[model samples]
Target: MPSRAPDDIERAHLRDPNDRRFTIARRLPPEPLRAWLRRFWIPVWDVPDGESAAQRVLQYPVCLSITTPGYSRFVGPNPGLSTTVLEGRSWGFGTMFAPAAGAVLSPGTLRDLAGTHCDLEQIPALAGLTEPVRVLMAEDPSAEETHAACCALVEERLERLGVPGEEDLLINAIVEEVEGDSSLLTVGQLGERFGLGERSLQRLVSRRLGLTPAWLIRRRRLHEAAGALRGTEELAELAARLGYADQSHFTHDFRTSTGSTPGEFARRWRDES
Candidate 1:
């Protein structure tokens, strides 16, 4: 396997150039499935004996379905950073699902499973896929055909769900709006833009996404902030662009979530880059 750049660098994750024990490949889903699934990522790792490496992700505000040699799970939207450790020579096949698709695939409401995961075998639609996906990944974790076969299995399962319902489409659109528009900084603004009342919007988001509308805005800003910090933009200007009242407020929020001040994070990013 060869080292490839991340599919979306703005999305936060921890990586070390010195540790070249892993290679990841990400491919977009088929066009018809794009509305429900974001992409498929396959990561193959070969850590040396007696050593371990950690992979951290500031996950997007959506759900994930990940299959590894040991386990297969349906992971809910994580409200904060997530970390996974890797050891030995192994691989993982994971999919980032759209906001609307979580409820459809999860055994219970999204609200019940936030920040946690359940066995994939529990989900009727996804049960049969675990073993086959695992076998294909094990055979050739770095092969293009392996990736396509995994995707094909998922696509076949999802096609049985038929067209997404009206609410599913609405939530997908709502997430798209929140992610694309930097000007939407508050729940009120999001409600107005979507013609939904605060409580109604809150209910919809919490039920389908297991998160508050406010979290959606903050996550988007932080993701953009992390990406922007890699550049040379002034802190004050960056804060203003992301709808923060001031740089201090922005720094406070970033520090609270990431345990490091924006300046410190930026410096580390620069040093690492």
Candidate 2:
């Protein structure tokens, strides 16, 4: 029998019966794009249809993804922050004051982003930050966890630098709200809580987060809803707790974002715990 090649949109690899860590074969050409940013991107990996040996990795960097359902490219950046896009079933988001130019970045765009080993490992007096210099940055398993941890660490670093506490406070606030309950966090609320005008906070957060406050709210709530459905609650209650008006709303949003319903997701596989 002739062996079939991998299809576009599916990354395939030879799988070992035992030892399931991660396996990536290859991917197809990304679908062409109309616009760069301003929406979520759907990159069908140009790999084969094979079991993802990787235990659905939950960790990666934390950079707000801004692309459309159409493509994974980006336009000009939100000021004061940068992102290092990576490849995986998941993505990342975080906030960092854009470092000065001439600094190294992760392997996102390297015509080349990394110059030398010194730049790669320097850690820039900002300790928690992983320089965008890793050849295998995207492949790291604990990527998101590490990035979120870095954000927390950078909070302390900025404090030591005598940066005004508000910006860092605001970052922590958004992170907490996103990590917890985004249903209640609003841009207007952030402005009122921090005494900044709405526009000002919007600009600040957009610059730092690379996303609007509403995006953060939606991302966090959706994330929580997914967690609740898989780990904690039934679909009906999960939808309500995550602030969806009802289960149908939850199903719609979930299918739109993840291409699956709560019941489908829950029943598709056994709990890994």
State which candidate has the highest lDDT: 1
RMSD to native, candidate 2: 14.5
lDDT of 2 by residue, 141-246 (tens): 2343433333344344434443334454455555455555555756687567657787886676555444456665665565565455545567887787777888
lDDT of 1: 0.85
Listed in order, each prediction's TM-score against the native is 0.93, 0.46
Tens-place lDDT digits, model 1, residues 174-200: 999998898888999999988999999
TM-score of candidate 1 to 2 decimals: 0.93
lDDT of each: 0.85, 0.39
Model 1 collision count: 0
Q: For candidate 2, give the lDDT.
A: 0.39
Candidate 2: residue 74 Cα off by (Å):
14
Candidate 2 TM-score to native? 0.46
Candidate 1: regions farther than 4 A off:
1-6, 17-19
